[model samples]
Target: MKIFNLPLSESTFEKRAPFYGRLSATIEDMRGKTKLVLRLLLLFVAKHEIEATNWKIIALWGMG
Candidate 1:
């Protein structure tokens, strides 16, 4: 098996490394924001359901 050595410049590697690092960090930040939004949405839905059930109970009791 022949091993092929790829030529890479020091400056090119350095620039690309930092660029990829920043891109990865941005992706992580976006994921965190998405998770937070999903959690908030779930909490809001749960609260809305609870309030709806309570209103239904109140209406039934008032009618009787």
Candidate 2:
């Protein structure tokens, strides 16, 4: 992946720390367990609401 002209290799993506992945995994895993995952979504949204955007990390995952 390329972000801000920086090249990101597969290994770099794979080597991301758990801090970058755990909540995302939790969100995916929670899918289908409940008819409405509003609470889970709220948690995610609320987090992003409070924190500053880290485009480098988001782009590392090909997101944002």
Identify the leading candidate in terms of lDDT: 1
Q: Which stretches of candidate 2 lie over 4 Å from their true place?
A: 1-36, 53-64
lDDT of each: 0.88, 0.67
* Stretches of candidate 1 exceeding 4 Å from the true structure: 1-14
Candidate 2 lDDT tens digits, 7-43: 2786766666464589678777777556367878888
> Which clashing pairs does model 2 show?
none
Query: Model 1, range 1-64, lDDT digits (tens) per residue?
Result: 7574333888776768877789789999999999999999999999999999999999999999
Q: In terms of TM-score, how similar is model 2 to the real structure?
A: 0.26
Show the colliding residue pairs in model 1: none
